[model samples]
Target chain A: MTKNLSNVNQIIAKYQGDQSALIQMLLEIQRENRWLPKPVLARLSQKLGIPISQIYHIATFYKAFSLIPQGRHTVSVCLGTACHVRGAPRLLDRVTDTLKLNPGETSVDYKFTLKTVNCLGCCALGPVMVVDGEYYGKPSAKEIEKVIANCD
Target chain B: MKKLQKVTLTINDREVTAKEGMTILEAARDAGIYIPTLCYHEKLAPYGACRICTVELSRNGRSRLVTSCVYTVENGLIVKTESPKVIKVRKLLLELMLASSPAKAIQDLARQYGIEKRRFEADKTNCILCGLCVRYCSEIKQANAIGFVGRGTERRVVFHPEIASTVCASCRECFSLCPTGKLPSETDGVCFDDLTLDDFLKTQQSPA
Candidate 1:
């Protein structure tokens, strides 16, 4: 699917073309376009008067930026120490089985992007599975299915 | 121009005088003290990426390890290039580098440190992530055609195909800066759309 992406100029302009706010501009662009296209990076390089290689460096360095297309929903499973002891791996396996998408991979239909995070800083919610921002604690397979089913 | 202030320091029990802002590596090099380095180049800024130049620094009876390439010289500072701690750090760094790059420079360093083999699994990507090519392009050449991408073990050097195709042929300065020689070998790889420097030059030579 093609996104209009005309708003990319507006996003860059919002930051007043400040080189320091490169990450901020990228984040806003990612939020709007779901991914950073090559042409978009080239456009950003031209507009900012910065090198395309430098922009590519920033895009690839941060975990927040996605060079490839991302799905509508972001499903993250915490695999922190606490979550690990609470069967987070098994929970991740269940989610992977349900979505048929491994960590760092998006679904073909653009429904979900499954990811495994080291920690969410919520130790109380061990083995936490978060979809779109809603956190679930040690959810069973059925609960996982119900949550995924509700997304689309 | 204001006269550059000098600082006196002890390196390997030898008194050495250096400019105030000079790094330990520079001071040592000037004083004829040999300290092995990988990611350090005189033309480029002190990156301190490769820890091979790690040295034992002492001040106020306190000693700690620091990369000499970026660490500035100070009055009464004692630097040890081949201390037990520094040797261990260099040895381990050499071993780790040997696993990935095992190139001439790395092998020579490994041999110096008595590292026969690396204990870690060999993942020979050849490119040591030294940033020489990247830094040379950006700092010296100001071309910015190549740069480092990703973080940690996932990090690698990549070329901007658009910029490289335009600037790299006439300016192959970075080709010689690479310590591991990955640049020349990977020039025709997917990054340049399978276009070699010779191919680029040939196309340039051909009439339109």
Candidate 2:
């Protein structure tokens, strides 16, 4: 927060502080910071001349932005209709038990953040999980555990 | 001046005439029919959120369920406000909403409809993620302080920490519009456990 406020300003300037670019701006902020801090959002709102509430609205509307600190590796289990039908629930259970964290919660040590997504748009690869933007299709419990172990 | 054109439609078993622009819900109300709604407000613009006002429409050899609050009337239209299919869908929606908030007002309404238990998993907390407060702030007060964020099951009402930290006590307009009392409090207000029927009924109509 002490230094990234300026970084957020640079991203806002790159977007020309346009109101319509709010989503992209936040995405960039998330890209740089991995999660959106309240201070960065306030600074962006001030620079962009948009209401803070409206900015929060946009931030919350999208699943990409995180309001709090996120783990280095994010585990999103696809619970979409296609994945669900293909046994995503079992994958989710296995992942959560191994990670010792539930959806919407980061581990106490911040090693991982687990979440369940409606779909990851890879229906053919039912029961998928993504870690740091890398997709693992048809992941089994032992495979998911090994993947997380290697993420450090 | 042009006369107001009327559309003749059948609601339930009775023939009713309503203005061409009037919605089916309004037309049914004009014909003395009752339709439960969660998001409709006379003051704010129509938002078809709860889907409880859904009714079946049959015309031209086709039948479909449309939310009466938004769907308009047409000539020779047949409407069944309480069709079995409509009830089944409404019950499902109500169960989902009940799982989220379990508000007394909503529970009473559901009980009247004979719904007993939640059929699906409850994935959310109170507030039901309805946008009534967000809409009230934006449209009515123009405050832009709160809003709905995310999509699908992750959708929820989010507040501006800076603004909400200070302005909540002074401005409570959204409190009334929120069907679930989760907003505006960590305790007290319309939260089910905060008070009882006798205390609440003292101020408003008793649902029981």
Tell me, per candidate, how large a share of the native contacts it keeps.
Answer: 0.51, 0.46
For model 1, the docking class works out as acceptable
Q: What total of clashing residue pairs does each candidate reach?
A: 0, 3
- Number of the top candidate by DockQ? 2
| Interface DockQ of each model | 0.32, 0.36
Query: lDDT tens string, model 2, B2-33?
Result: 78798999999899999988999999888889
**Per-prediction CA RMSD (Å):** 6.5, 7.8
Q: What is candidate 1's lDDT per residue for B158-194, written digit by digit as tens? A: 7777777778778788777777777777675225334
Model 1 per-residue lDDT at A83: 98
Quality of model 1 by C-alpha lDDT: 0.83
lDDT of 2 at B160: 53
- lDDT of all the models against the reference? 0.83, 0.77
**For residues A1-152, could you state the per-residue lDDT of candidate 2 as single tens digits?**
67799898788788777889989888888988778888898888778888776876677667787777878888888889999999988888898788888787777677787877787788998888998889999987788889999999
How does candidate 1 fare on TM-score? Answer: 0.92
Among the numbered candidates, top lDDT falls to 1
